[model samples]
Target: MGRARFAFGVLAFGYAFLYLPIAMVIVYSFNESRLVTVWSGFSFKWWQALFANEAMLQAAWLSLRIAFASATTAAVIGLAAGYALVRARRFPGRTLFGSLVVAPMVMPEVVMGISMLLLFVGSERLMGGPDRGFLTIAVAHITFSIAFVAIVVQARLTDFDRSLEEAAMDLGATPWVTFRTITLPLLLPAVGSGWLLAFTLSLDDLILTQFVAGAQSQTLPMRVYSSVRLGVDPQINVLATIVVSVAACALMLSGWLTRKKV
Candidate 1:
């Protein structure tokens, strides 16, 4: 009883510590005052201002496009890689390939960003290709996002019953048909989770995007960074509030889906 109570107390304290600043930010987003510290009264002017900011709006749109494309590509590639890694037996270099697939997850983001930038620059120089901009950023996002998707899918595959797949094959179904009918249905939840995870990561990324994005390819985080560096504004708070709300909704939907599946 004492240990359980102690664990609960620690968890509560940790949660409060992590969320207190977020709660404060959300509350103060409604403040009417220009100053972030002083709370005059509640107003919706900041929220309106956020919508009115043309640069921010453009950046948000670009970010949405990059996130959607990168996540979709990552989900497809990761699904295939994860399925192979988890199901294939006695294949050559399987161990090395699995490690390579997961390398991005453990690697430092700055190192990955710099490496990707160098790779793109070298490619451009050699091939005399067009400049790297949105395409480069999307590719970088997809590269890292695949690692996340693979991890999620691999977790789901760990507990899966392989015998079901074997049963499908034994019933005279072709390998492709067995995989399509039996394995894919069981992996749908993982696929959805991976897609959402990839999208969220791409949307939130700043370091890698900073390295890869061109002058005209500003993402929402890059825009926010520039704005906050100049000075703190009420519009930033409002933007933060909107982002948090959206993230919360996504998390809630993921949680509900997970529960339903269970």
Candidate 2:
């Protein structure tokens, strides 16, 4: 009983430590007062103000576009990498390829951001394309996001049954047909989970985004960071609430999809 009590107490303390700040943020987002330290009852004024803030709204819209594009591209590439790692018997540089695909999953954000920045700068100098704003940011996001999706996909494929594909190919279907008609449908849940995970990573990324984002390509996270530096607004709290809600929903859905049976 003492051990159980200790475990429960630790769990409760950890939960409170993580979520108490988020709960405070959510509650303060509705404060009627300009000063966040004091609550002056609830108000919808901040929500109205958030809508009126054009810079924040524009940055949010741009972030959504980049996240969507980056997630989709990462999903496709990660799926291919996962498939190759699992399904293919042997290939040249298979070990190196697998290592490269998952290296970002454990890599530091600062390291990745600096590396991506240097690559983009050099590429722009030589090829003279993709500029430094939207395209560069999107590509940077994809580079990191791919690792997450690849890890998710590789885990899913580890338990996958290859007999279904083998049976299809054995019966008169080509490899491409078997993959499209049989494998893709069964892998949809895992793919969806990976995509959502990648989307959240890209959307919430500020460190990496800061390195690649140009002056015109400010994202929602960048906007929020700048706003907080000047002083906290009720609207910043409101934006935090919205972002947290979105991220929570995405994570919950990703968990659901990951657990879904094929």
lDDT of every model, 2 decimals: 0.89, 0.88
Candidate that would win on TM-score: 1
Summarize candidate 1's per-residue lDDT along 19-134 as a digit string, tens digits: 98888888889999999889999899898888999999999999999999999999999998888888887699998989989999888999999999998888889997557778
lDDT over C-alpha atoms for residue 161 of model 1:
86
* TM-score per candidate: 0.95, 0.94
Q: List the residue pairs that clash in candidate 1.
A: none
Model 1, backbone clash pairs (residues 3+ apart or across chains), number: 0
Stretches > 4 Å off in candidate 2: none
- What's each prediction's clash count? 0, 0
